[model samples]
Each structure stands twice: as C-alpha cells, then as structure tokens.
Target chain A: MEKKDTFIKAIQENERLIFKVASFYTDSKDDRDDLVQDIIYNLWKSFDTFQQRSSFSTWMYRVAMNVAILHLKQRKRKVPAVPIDLGALNFAETGFDGNEEKLQVLRKLMNDLNLFDKGILMLYLEDKSHTEIAEIIGISKSNVGTKLSRIKQKLRQQVNNQNQKTAWN
Target chain B: MELDELKSNWENSNNRPANQNSLTAKMIDQMIQTKYDAKLNKIRYPEIGGGLVCAIAIVFIACNFNQLDTAVTRSTGAIAILLLILLPILSFLSLSKLNFESAVSESHVQVLQQFAIDRLRFQRYQKMNVTLCYLLMVAIIILLPKFFYGKDLVINKAFWTFAFSFGYIFLLVFSRLMSRYYGRSLNQAEELIREIKETTANS
Candidate 1:
C-alpha cells in the first residue's frame, strides 16, 4: 500500500510528461487516453525496477518513450476499459492554452519525423540536455547533438517554406 | 517554428498549473489493480472459453466416434479432434511469447530492436495461425453435419460446390482483411527499424 502511494505520488508529479508523450504519439482522444493508460500501466509495472541512477522524470521519460514506440506502432489491442474517470482527468490538455496555433504547427512538424527523431525532438523541446537526452535515448551524447542539429535543420527548412508561402499569399 | 523558438513557447505555455483533478489514492489503486488483474488478461478469458468449448467438442466427438461410419467423417473426425487438442496449445504458446513485463526496464534502443525481432516472430505466428485457421475451418465444416445430424455432407456433390464457393470466399475475405490490417502495422515497424538503423550507423 505504501509502495502504491509512492508510485501514485510520482505519477501525479510527472503526469504532464506522460501526457505530453501520449499526445505526441496519438491524434485522437481515444488513442491518447489509451496511450496514457498504457504509459501509466507500464510505468507502474516497471516501477520496481527503477534504481534511480537518474532523476525519476528522466527514467520515467525513457520508459514512456520505450513503451510508446513498441506500443503505438504495434497493433492496438483494445483492453477492457477500466472504470477510471478519464473524462474528469484532463491530463493531456498540456496547459498550452494560449498557443494553440503554435502548438499545432509544432505538432505538425513533430508528426512528420519518425519515432526515433520525434523522441529526440521531444527531449529537445523539453530542454533536456544533450547528455541527459543521450542517457535517456541510449545514444552517445555526440549522436544526440548530431540528431538535434539535423532535426533543427529540417524544421528550419520547413518553417522557411511555410513563411515563404505565407508571404506570397 | 524553429526548434529554439518552439522550445521557448512550449516551456512558457506548459507553465500553467497542473489539472485540478489529481488522482486520489483510490483512483490509482483501481487503475493499477485493473491492470494487475489483466496480467493474465484479455486472452486468458478467451483461452478459458476456448478450452471449455474444445473440451465439449472433443467429448461430443469421442462419444459419437463409433457412429462415424463414412470415410470422410472418420478422417475429418480425427482431424477435428486433433485440432481441438492442438489449437489451444498453439494459442497458449504463441501468446506466451508476448510478455511486456521487462519492456520498460530496457533502454529505448534495446526495446525497439527487440520489438522488431519480436514483431517479425509475431507476424510469422499470425500467418501460421491464419493458415491453421483455414484448415480448422475446413475440418469443422466437413464435420459439422455429422455433429448436428448424422449426415455425411462430404459425400454430397452439392455440399462441395456450396461449401467451397461460399466457405473459401468467406475465409479468404476475412483473412485478406486481417492481412491488410497487420500489413500496415508491419510496414510502419519496418520503416521505423530502417530509420533507426540509419541513425545508429551514422551516429
């Protein structure tokens, strides 16, 4: 019971990160809820194995991304719905209320990247250091740096194209 | 739109307070317990259901074993009994390989790499299952008449025409639908693996 309490506290603390990852992976609300539930469940299951060499959030993000890649890309097997009040818990709303347009554009660009690069981009956007990003993603720090630069370049070109088109209009 | 600009915007916008509906201990317990019960989970229900059905089927087939007078019935009865015995074992074995208990403990690269191999193996098993199902469908159809009314439909010429035309087409369409569904996921995984491999090599 105490362990469960600890786990719940940890989850509530980092729930935003979980929702952020879930929203990045899924488009529809149903899929988002399912993914969030999955991330939470996986985190709970792997909770015992967490040795805490890193921050809890960092470890949690690793687990979240790992599950998301193997999960969201795999065939979605619908599990029985739990009776949790998912409707009441607007976790993935992200508090990005005023920047809907910017959020949409960021999401559009993020969606275009593959899962691997998206993970990198997500970590980058979260302002994760190259070292921490490398640690979480299991790449060398140099690789994290290299991937981020390439992703940035891709985003730059995309933004420039969008801007040019807008200017022409 | 640039990474830095978006990063700053995201950081700023994400600063709004967390939702008021923070989960209570009771809610957390329920959520976790729901999955805990599911540790044996969705397939377990079907497995139990299937095992009982198979048991009943095998019992019915055995009880009437002496009455299977025709060659097709006898041969297909044997096949159906074999199927009843083997299908459950096959399902249990295939599903047993899909454990995700240790997934979150592994690194992202390791997880994806293992997932690629596991997905291929799972795809192969699915293909085998579809083929086995085709055979099971045939065997069950051949034997249903015997089970219900002691008639040997295999001996009837019309039975073959009707069963093959309709049965094969039904199975074909169902299998095609399943294949297309899984094929999309397979393509996604394959593409992901390719891109990850390229990134790994370049890095």
Candidate 2:
C-alpha cells in the first residue's frame, strides 16, 4: 500500500516526461497510451530495485527511455510517432529568434533520426545536462558531447538542404 | 532559423506540458490491471499449452510403450516419446526469447544487444519447432490408436495413403499460415534493428 502510493506519486510527478519519451517512440495516441501503461507497469515492477543512490528524475528518465525502446521492439513502426508540442519550445531567445517554421523543420528532421540520436535530441531539448543525458543514455559524458555535436551538425546540414529545396520550390 | 538559434529558444523556454493526457488515479489503476503481456504475443500461451499437452503424452508413452506387443509398434512408441519431449522444448525456447519484462532493467545498449541475440534465438527455435512438428504429428497419429484402441494406423495401407496425402497438405498450409503470422514479429524486430544501425551509422 505504501509502496503503491510512493510509486504512483513518482509517476504522477513525472508523467509529462513519460509522455514526451513515449511520443519519441510511438506516434499514435493508442500506441502512446499502451507504451505509457507498459512504462508505468515496468516502473512499478522494478520499483523495488530503484534506490536513492541517484536522483529520482534521472533514474526515472533511464527507465522511461528504455521502456520506449523495448516498446518499439514489440510493435515496430516505419516512422516513429512524434507529437511535437509546438508550444513546448520558447522562440524568444537571444541571437536569432526561432519561429514555428523552424520548430516544424526540427520536428521533421527528428523524424529521420535513429532512436539513439532522437533520444539525445529530446534530452538536449529538455535541457538535461551532459552528465544526466549520458547517465540516462548509458553513454559516457564525453560520448554524449560528441554525439550531440554530431547530431546538431547533421540536423543543421539537413535543415540547410531542406531550406534550399524549399527556396527552389 | 539556425539550429543554434532554436537551441537558445528551447533552452530559454519555461517547462510546458508535453502531453495533454493527465495521470488520473483511475487511469493508473486501469494500467496496473491491464495484463496485456498474454495479449501481445498471440503465440505464447498456445505454445505453452501445446507443450503441456506434449508433456502429458510424453509421460503416457513412457508408461505404456512397454505394453505394446510388436517390435515395430514399440519402436514407433519410443519415437513418439522422443518427439513429444522435443516439441515442448522447442516451443518453450521460442517463447522464452520474448520476455520483455526480464530485460527492463538492462541499459539501452544492453537491451538492443540482447534483443538481437534473442531474435536470432527465437527464429532458430521457430525453425526447430516447424521442422519437428511434422514428426510430432506423425508420432501422435501412430501412437493414439495403439494407446486408446490397441490398433496401429501405420499398418493400414489405405489409411496411411490418405493420411499422408491429407495430413501433408494440411500441415503445409498450417505451417505456412503460422510462419507468415509469426513473421510479423520477426519483421518488426528487424526493422528496428536496421533503422538503429542506419541512424547510428551517421554518428
């Protein structure tokens, strides 16, 4: 009973994070719902193993991400279902302002990323630190740095080529 | 906007709700109750059930094989016992490869690596199952009449001819249909593996 309450409380607190992770893997609402259920179930099942050694959010992120990976294996999809929240990103930052079109472009490019890189991008967008991302992704912190740069460069190149195509049209 | 520009915006933005779905207590209870593991793989329970039936037949044959009179009938009974043992082992091997819950705590890389191994093992188990099922069926056909009515169907020429023709066709069709159905799972696994390889290749 106590166990259930704590687990449920943790899930409620991080449900949005779970949804974002689920969206990265599952496109449809039904699939997302199923994936969420599986994640929660697995979390509850493995809750006993979860210790206070790490931050609860970091541990939860690892479990959520892995569940999504395992979920995709059960029912493979050609295109991962990403329900990008347009309102999720703020466009009023310094340097150059980003608009909805840019968010759409980033979202479209994300569709082309592999599960690992897509996961990195999602983590990056969430502003998770290099250490946290590495811990969650099971890669070294330096590897996370390398991969982020590679992914960003790749995204930039793809966006450029896409913009060129758009201009041509 | 440049990727760097977008990064700034995303970094500067406050935490917004990513999914509109709320985590209601009712929803939590429903999720906890949804035991869809049995539902996900349509083949798992059927395979287990088949294995149990084979196990019963195995015990029955072990006890009764000595009571048969002829050498040929006794040899057939021995062979049937062997097949019954093999049948369940193969099916269980295949089913065990798909235990998603067991790998939940494994890291992402470990999970993928394990999945790759499991998928290969699964296909191998499936092949073994499909091949040995023919023998299992034949053994069951030969042994059932002996155990139940003290008769041998293999000795009857007409029955052998008709049974071979019809059973061969039926098993062929059944195996083909099942292979196609189960192949969806294999294909889905392969698709994820291939995409992962392709995307990771860029990095």
Candidate 3:
C-alpha cells in the first residue's frame, strides 16, 4: 500500500514532465498519449533500481525520451499508410485561437527542428536552465549554450520567413 | 515582443489536455504485470536452446560410446560438448534478463546507453555462435581417426574426407551468413537511434 501510494504520488507530481516530453516527440494527442503510457511503463519497470542518486525528474525525462525514440523506431518499421489527425484537438481549449493557418505554420516549424533541439527548446520553454538542460540532454554546459543560441536564431528566422510570406499574401 | 514573452505566449496559447492521471496509473499497473509475468516465466521453464543442446549432446555421446572405449575419454567428450552448448545458452539467458525499464526510470540518458549495450551483446552472441561452430568441427575432427580405422565403417575414406572438408566450408559459410544477418539488424537499430538524435537536436 505504501509502495502504491508513493508510485501514484510520483506519477501525479511528474505528470506534466511526461506530457511535455511526449508532446515534443509527437504532434497528435493519440501519439502523445501512447508515448506517455510507454514512459510510465518504463518508469514502473525501473522503480526497483532507483538508487536515489539523481533527481526523480531527471530520471523520468530519460525514460520518456527513450520510450519516445523506441516508439518512432517501431512506427518506422510498421510503416502505416494513414497519417494521424490532429484537427480535432481544440487549440482554443489550450487557449490558442482555432486558426487553421497559424496552427499549420506552427506545426511545420516544429517539425523542421531535430528531435534533440526540440527537446532542448521544449525544456527551455518550460523554463529549465542551461545546466538542467545539459544534465537532461547529456551534453556539456557550453554546448547547451551554443545550441540554445543557434536554435533561437533558427526559430526567429523561420518565424520571420512565415511572417513575410503572410504579409506578401 | 521580447523573446521570453513570445515563448511564454506560445506556451500559454497552446492549451493541451490536462495530464491524464488515471491513464498513468493504469500504465504502471500494466508494467508491473508484465514484469511479474516475465520473472515467473524465467523461473518456471528451462531455456529452449539450453534444453535442445543438452538433448543433442546426450544423443551424440550415447551413439559414440562403443567408439569411445575409454571411460575417461567418453566422459571428457560429453563434458566438453555440454560446456560448449551451455556457454552460449547461459550468456543468452543472462542478456535477456537485463532490466531496460529500470534504466529508463533512472535517467533519460540511460535509454541510449542501454541500446548501445544491447548492440554489444548481439555482437558477442555472434562471436559465441562462430566459436561454437569451430568447437563442433574440432570434435568431428577428433572422431575422424576412429572412423577411418574401422574397416566396417559405413562410409568410404574418400567420402569421409570430402565430408570433413565440406563441413569446415559449411561452418565458414554459416558464420558469414549469421554475421551478416546480425550486422543488418544492428545497423537498423543504430539508424533508428541516429534518426531520434537528429530529430531531437533539430526540433
């Protein structure tokens, strides 16, 4: 009973971390849900070996990343012909206007970035610092700084390009 | 707008669903069940390969008892074959029991680390298979002299010699084929990892 409670508490506390990581890896709600489930499953399996050497969140992030990566690999192998529909998810419920055009542009830009950069930027947006990001990503602190700087510049360019095209129209 | 404001606005504007608490609980339950099943299965049954190899060694030794007149030589042959068969099976079982899930919960970084370890294990298995084939060939070679000396041995000397040579060639071909198969699988796994890395780095 104590173990179950602790496990449930851990899940409740880290739920956002799982969801955010899943969202970065997958665009659709269904995929995000699957990724989150996989991460949770992985975490449960690893529960006994948790030595308390590192923070729980850091460990959870690693598990989430792994599950997401494996899911992508399996998807590639299976090669489903139909694409998932993200249209039904109300951006408005999340507070974004239900503007198809803007949403389409945002989705495209998100897809343009690589998985690692996406993860970094997602953590950044969640307000994780260079040191924390570096710890999560298994990179040097300086590398994180450089990568974050470059990522921001790339994002700015993409947004500017989109804005210019919109204005021209 | 400032960069921080823009990021905050983007984050605020993208209202995703509230994290599903119930689903997370269910997933944990599923994981526990799976782990329990795996453990029970391991405890209850002998490994398929280990059992098969033991049976084969017993049959081989039983058939060749008359030829191996000396008890010491016969016992040594049986023990050698058993060890050769057992080594790969034990190694495989140990590798199979590795806890990938625990590593994941420990840290996100350990995911890739685990995968790299898995690839190494596959390589080791390939080497073990090749070694086992060689050991079998050596056993056959040792037994060849007894067959050659027996006038009533079913096969002719020419046929025996040809078969021995062909067996060595067959081992080489088999090793090459198995290596290629494992190499392709490893390459595919690596490619998938690389793709994930690239996607994460860029996104």
Candidate 4:
C-alpha cells in the first residue's frame, strides 16, 4: 500500500512533464491533453519495469516522448473536425491575454517547425544544457549544439522579418 | 529578439492548458482508458487483420480447387500449396528474428512503428500481386475458348485473342491508375512513420 501511494504521488508530482512534452508535440489543446494522458497511462503500465538505472524523471521523459511521437503519427491519418486557429488561443478568453502578441508570434514559429526541431527547441527553451538536450533527444551533444545554433539564427531572422513587416504596417 | 528572450517568452507564457478543471480531468481519464485498451488489443492480437485474411483465403481456395479448369487448377493448386507451406515457415522465421519485448520496450516504440510501416508496404505489394494475377486469369479465360473451337469458331482466334489482350492491357492500366490513387495515402502513412522515427531517433 505504501509503495502504491508513493508511486501515485510521484506521478501526480511529475504530471507537468506530460503536459509540457505533449504541448511541444501537438498544436491542438485537446490533442496535447490526450497525448499527456497516453504518456501517463503508458508510464503506469510500464511502472513495474522502472529500474533504478536512471532517475524516475528520466524514465518518465523517455516514455512521454515515445507516446507523443506515436500519437502524432496516428493523428496524421485522421482529418481534423475543426481547424485549429493558433490566433484564437491568444485572445483574452483563452487565458493568454497578457502577452498575447508575443505568445502568438512564438506559437506561429513553433508551429512551423517539424517534429524533431520542435522537440529540440522545446527542451532548449526549458533551459536544458546541450548535454541534457542530447540525452532527451537521443542525439550527439555536438549535433544538438549545431542544430541549436542554426535554429536560433533562423528564429532571429523570423523575428526580424516580423518586426519589419509590422513597421511597414 | 534574442534567443534568450524568445525562450523566456515561451517558458513564461500562460498559453499552456490549464491543469485544474473537471473537463481536463475527464479528458485525461478518457485518453488513459483509450490508450490502455489499445495496448491490450495490441498484446492480445499482435498480428494485423491482413494475416487473418490470408489464412482464410488459403482455406477458401483449398476448398474450391475443383471448380477451376485443369491447367489453372493445377497451377493454382501448386502455388497455393507452396504458399500454405511457406506462410507458417516464413512467419516463424520472422518471429524468431523479432525481439518482441524489446520492440515494444518503452524506449523503442519508434522501432515498432517502422515495423508497422514495413508491414503496410508488404500488404500493398500483396494487393498489387493479387490484382495483376486476377487480370491475367480473366484474359486467359476469355482466350481459352478461341483455341478449342479452332477454324469452326465464329470469331477468329487471333481476333478474340487480340481483343482479350487489349482488355487485359486496359485492366492493367486501370490497376495502375487505382494503385496510384491509393499510393498517395500510402505515401502519407510512410511519411508519418518517417516523422516518428526521425523525431524519436533524434530525441
């Protein structure tokens, strides 16, 4: 009973990992939440095999990423019932009222990225080191460094372009 | 903006889903239930429905061999017999090569997705083979009468042979057209698999 309680408590504590990882992969709010649930469910199912080779968080992240990627692949097969408008999430009604413009621009840029780029960018944004990012992304540290350098340059150019277009307006 | 600023903006933003609501809880619950059920279904029946259909087809063909003409019957019987003997052997070979538990291990879903894509390609090839074989059989059936009736046949054997050949050619063209139509979807599925593999591998 104590072990079960501890496991459940750990899950509840680390639940935010699911949301963050899921949001990185999925654009739609519903799909993001669904992906999070799938990740958690997978973690629970595989809980018995959770060896102490790595920290629980590391294990959880691995499971979360696997589920998110798989879910994204499955999602491609179905047509969306309603098109998601990234702009709509920026409105006051959606709880993003304070920094709507910045959030909207960032969301647009993130949405433009392919899945692998998005995963790397998300981890980078979360302040993970290149080494840690490589572990999370299963890439070499040098590869992560090069990719991040290019990604940063691309993002800077995009922001500049957006600013210039705004100035013209 | 600087990279740090952009990263900060994303991190500090409140655009993320609110975690504390009944609706959110219910949605998460549903997702968990659905994933659990899917996992159960996968474990209970790892083989896809295509394998089951192939098994049934072998049984049906075996039971209907007498209905076909002697030459076709003999050729098909030989082929069917070969397939029946080969299927289990091939399946066992592949199964032996598979590391089933490792393929589905928490760290290796991407590998499993690749396997699924390969299976889909094999299924598509099978469908194309069946289509081509059927078209050929239809042509053979139409032309066989011409050879038997010999000069007494109202229509010339060569004429009917050419006609059947033209029809067969048209069927082949049609099959290609249909395959192209379905090919777009298969391409999309393949792309999804590639995306999953690349993402997981990179991560």
Candidate 5:
C-alpha cells in the first residue's frame, strides 16, 4: 500500500512529462490517452525495481519513451502516420499561440525524428541539460551535444529555406 | 517563429495542447484493470486448456493401471505421473521467464535486449520440450510389446503402418509450424535490437 501511494505521488508530480511523451508519440487523442495509460501501468508494475538510480522523472521518461516507441512501431504496421521533424518548422520571430496550425506543425516535426533523437529533442524542449538528456537516454554527453548541434542546424536550414520562398513570392 | 521563441511559447502553453484531458487515479486504475484482464485472458485460456488435458490423461492412465498388470504397465504409469508433473512445470517456467509486463518500465533498447534474450531462451526450451515428448512417445511404443510379453497381443500390420505414418506426418507438420512461429519472432527481435543499436551508436 505504501509503495502504491509513493508511485501515485510520483506520477502526480510528473504527469505533465507523461502527457508530453504521449503527445509526442501519438497524433490522436485516443492514441495519446492509451499511451499514457500504458505508461502508468508499466510504471506501476515495475515500481519495485525502480531503485532511484536516477531521478523518478528521468526514469519515467525512459519508460515512457520505450513504451511510446514500441507502440508506434507496432501501430505503423496497421496505419500510416507521419513522423514529425521540428528541424523543418519555421518558428515565427514572434511565436504563434499554441494554435491549431502551430500544433500541427509541431506534431509533424516530432514525427520526423527517430526514437532516439525524439527522446533527445523532448528533453531539449523541456530545457533539460545535455548531461540529463544523455543520462536518461543512455547516450554519452558528447554525443548529445553533437546531435543537438546537428538538429539546430537542420532547423536553421529549414527556416532559411522558408525565408527564401517568402522573399521569392 | 524562432526556435528560442518557440521554447517560450511551449513553456507558456500550459504544459500541453489545449484540449488535453486530465487523468485521475480512478481512470488510470480502470485502464490498468483492462490491460490486466486482457493479459490474463491471453495466459488463462491456453494454460487452463493444457492443464485440463494433462489432468484427464493422468486420470485415465491411473484408472487403467490395474487392468494392465505388468512391470511395463507399472513403469508406464510412473512415466505418466512424471509427465503430469514435469511437462506443466516446464511450461510454467517458460511462461514465467517472459516479462511482457515489465517491458514498459525498461528503456527501449534495454527492453528489446531483454525480450530477445527471453525469447531465445523460450524457443530453445520449447524445442527441447518437443524433442522430449517425441522420445517419450517412442519409448511408450517400444515398451508396449514388453507389456504383452506373456500374453498373446494381436495387432494388425496394416493398422500399425497407417497409425505410424499418420503420427509421423502430424509430428512433422507440428514441428514445422512451431519452428516457423519462433523463427519469425526471433527475426523481429533481432531487427529491433539492431535498429536500436544503430540509432544510439555514436557516428
């Protein structure tokens, strides 16, 4: 009972992170809900084995990312869904509200990244440090730095291309 | 919007999409219960069916033990009892080793690795189990003649030939199906593991 209470408390604290993961992986509300539920169940099931080697949120991200990726992989066989790549989006200098168009663009960008990169990007978006991202995804800190640089470059290129198109018009 | 500007909006966007629904403990519990019931259904039907078959076989053999009063018959009954205990234990061990539930807590790569290892172990266990069953069947066939050593047991050659042919064909097909099933699963696991390795590997 005590353990269950602890697990619930941890989840309550980090519910937003769980929601972020589910939203990143899935497009539809139904899918997102299912992903969140699945992640929670998994967290509950393995609550005992979580020895706090890392922070609970970090561990939760690890678990959530795994479940989401696997779920996406399996679902891919049945329905075709776009991968989002944030690198390709043109963020307005004055960012748009979390409007429908912005959300759609964000979703598409998320779809384009592979699972590992997706994990890194999710952490990056959350303002997590390179070291923390590396620790969560089991990658080296240097690699995380390199990947983030490359990703930023990609985003820059996309933004430049969009600018060129607007100038031409 | 600039990436940095997007970050501010993201943080200010109330943590998620506007329509995002809040989840409660009750809702989560319901979802967990649904998943648990589904998993239970997956294991329950096959396991219970297998258990029932084994129970019936053991009971039938025990009831007929007195009718066939021979050292060979007694040994056959002993073998039946052994199988009644051994086969289920083997099945249970194989099933228990698979941690589908725990995969949720592991990282993607770690889960794939663990699942691949568990699957390979299970496939090997299943193959050994099939071989043991075939050997036991052959042993029973060979020992039946011994049970009829002092008595005159009439058997038709044609019936024996047909029975052996049918049994062999069935065993061959069953073995092939099992091989194919395990082979496909192993391939999938291997591919997933390789993909994860590649994704995480430093360039």
Candidate 6:
C-alpha cells in the first residue's frame, strides 16, 4: 500500500482513541486540537520505526500518549494556566454521546489530579491492562495499580464533597 | 461516579465519527514543516541580533581608526578590531551546532530529558554571550581613550584609573546577576528532568 493511504487508514481506524487521549491532556478545545495535531504529526514521523512489535493499536497508544504528555509539559512551561473556554468545550463532541454532564464532571475531577495521576486515570478509564498501561506510561505495573487506586479514591472523595455541598446549598 | 461505572461510560464513548477527514496528510506535512521552520528561526533570531551589534561596533571602530599613534594605542586598536570580527563569528558557529532536529520516535522521558539538556545548553550560551559582550564593551571603553587622547591620559591618569576600576566592578556585579537569572532557568529544567525520572522509574 502507498504510505499516505496506509497512514490515513490507520488514523481513521484510531481517531476516537487519539481524540480521547488528547482531550485528557488538554482542557480547551483549541489546545486539544493542537495536541491531536501534534500526536498525528509525531505518529506519521515515527511510523517508519513501528517495527510491528505490538499491535498497531497498541503502538498508536504509545505514540499518542507520549505526544500528549510532552505537549502538556511544554504548555505548562509556557503558560502556567491553560486558557480554556468552558463554553467552547460544550461544542466539541467528546464521543461520550449522551453523558455530557458526566464528561464535564469527569473533566473537572481530572483537573484536580497531577500530571502523573492524570495519565494513570486516563489509561485506567480506557480499560487497559495494568501491564499495557505500564508499558505505555513507562512505569511499573504495580505502580500503575497503586496510582490508579489512589486516583479513584481521590475522585470518590471529590464527588462526595460535591454532593455534600449540593445538599448544604 | 465510581471507577467501574466510569469505565463503562468510557468504553461506550468510542462511538465517534469513523472518518479521517479532520486532519489530512497535507496538514500533517505542513505541521512538520512548520515545526522545523520555527526551530531554525529561533536560532536565526539570535544570530541576527549578534550580527547587528557586530556591525555597529565595526562602524564605530572604523570611524575612530585615525586616533592610533603610540604602540599602546596601536595594540589596543588591534585588539578592538580583532574582537569586532571574532564575536559574531563565534556566536554563529556555536549556534549552528544547536540546530538539533527533535525526533518524534523518542519516548516522552527521552524527549523531556533531551529538552532539559538542550535548554540548559542554550541558556548557558546566552549567558556567555551576554558576559562576553559586556566585557568587550568594558575593554573598549578603557582602551579607547588611550588611543584617541594619549596626551590627556598622562594628565588624568587617576581619572582613567577610576573609570577602569568602576567598569570592572560593574562587569563583575552585572555578570553575577545575569548568571543568577540563567541559573534559575537551568534549575527549572533540572527539576523537570528529576520529575520525569521519578515518575517513570520502575521503583
């Protein structure tokens, strides 16, 4: 197959996964779009070195996740606060279908986590195996489990606190 | 929501449009080109700034070349002329080595580590450039009078001595201040590297 044909096919097959990864790393639609473009750019650059050691989807996960994390770090260095239009987020479809409220609250919860925990939570939410998450994130499997458990606990506490505030209000 | 419930929502969320129309191959190629262009332009800006300063110094020296008479004045003029040629050439050579193309195949940790190293290298080069220019200015100021007015120097030896002393003190203090500023950036890069290592390490 031609390179462009294969590249487009791969991206078409994995756009949703890539979109989720980019959205997890960036809060604003503009930033998310930039991150996605960067991920695609990096993927195309590294495609020749894919070597097919793992499944193509797995390779996509590795490349997309790494690009997202690097983008996040560079943005953090450039601007401490990511300028996000809360309303603009409402326009972009997160692929969550009818669960817009859930997605919003989840994004809020994610904002409370540090960069490392955010990666763990993103991978965990994808239902990836601990070993797979570890490989993608370059951390130990046990560390992934430990961090995921802690992240879940943190999310539960935040939800509970929100519920308390609603009841009081 | 609970963890299990969130997983179900996430898995169900994969029903995005299955077309690859958003970012085309042409767009990707453009992004790659823009990325390198931006990198090269970064190095070019500094080179241009250094070149301008060099040009101005050469013009100033050329207009004042007739003042050299004694051996002391002649040697000072020669040193000034040498620096007028040397500074920009050295800056361009060092900056040429720093046009490193970032590889997309590298891992996140590898990329971050390389970024920290490259940034530190660039910052150090900037610090050195600033210091060298300041010292060169001081040297010229101290020597220029001896070339242009050697007779006045004998009558006002104390005044020239005082000016040189003040200039050296200013150079020392200003260079320290500049180093501190650059040092903070280097420290920030080092801290970032440490954070990446800690997060990625198996332990």
Best by TM-score: 1
Model 4 regions more than 4 Å off: A27-30, A48-55, A73-114, A153-169, B1-9, B15-38, B42-60, B70-203
lDDT of residue B114 for candidate 5: 61
| Root-mean-square deviation of candidate 1 | 4.7
lDDT tens per residue, model 2, A1-169: 8888888888878876776676666666567666767787788778887877778888778788778877766664212222332222221111113355554555578777666677778788788998888777676777778878888788888878887998999
TM-score of each prediction: 0.75, 0.58, 0.51, 0.58, 0.54, 0.59
Q: Give per-residue CA lDDT, model 5, range A1-169, as digits (tens).
A: 6776667767767777887787777766556666666677777877787788888888888888877765654443222222222112221222245475676556555555444556677788889887788777776778778877766675666667767988999
Q: After superposition, how far is residue B193 of candidate 1 from its true place, in Å?
A: 3.1
Most accurate candidate by DockQ = 1
What overall lDDT, based on C-alpha atoms, would model 2 receive against the true structure? 0.69
- Please give the distance, in angstroms, between residue A126's alpha carbon in candidate 2 and its true position after superposition: 4.7
TM-score of model 1 (first chain only)? 0.87
Docking class of 3: incorrect
Worst 10 residues of 5 chain B by lDDT: B146-155
Candidate 4 lDDT over A20-133, as tens digits, reads 777777766667655655666667667777787767876777667766666654564322222223223232122234877776777778776555566678778878888777
lDDT per residue, candidate 6, A14-125, as tens digits?
A: 7778777887777676677667666776787778888886778777887887777567545632222222222332335565777688777877887776555666677788
Question: At residue B5, what lDDT does model 3 achieve?
Answer: 49
Evaluate residue A131 in candidate 3 and report its C-alpha lDDT on the 0 to 100 scale.
Answer: 80
What are the candidates' individual DockQ scores? 0.47, 0.19, 0.22, 0.24, 0.17, 0.23
lDDT of residue A55 for candidate 2: 85
Choose 1 or 3, whichever is better by TM-score.
1
Q: Give model 1's docking category.
A: acceptable
Give the alpha carbon lDDT tens digit for every residue of A57-151 in model 3: 87677667767766664443222212322233221232355555544555566677655566677677778777877777776677777777877
RMSD of 3: 10.0
Worst 10 residues of 4 chain B by lDDT: B146-155
The per-prediction tally of clashing pairs is 0, 1, 19, 3, 12, 0
For model 1 chain B, the run of ten residues with the poorest summed lDDT = B14-23
Tens-digit lDDT track of model 2 for B58-158? 88888987667787778878888887787777776665644566667666655665665677677868777777777767767877888899877777999
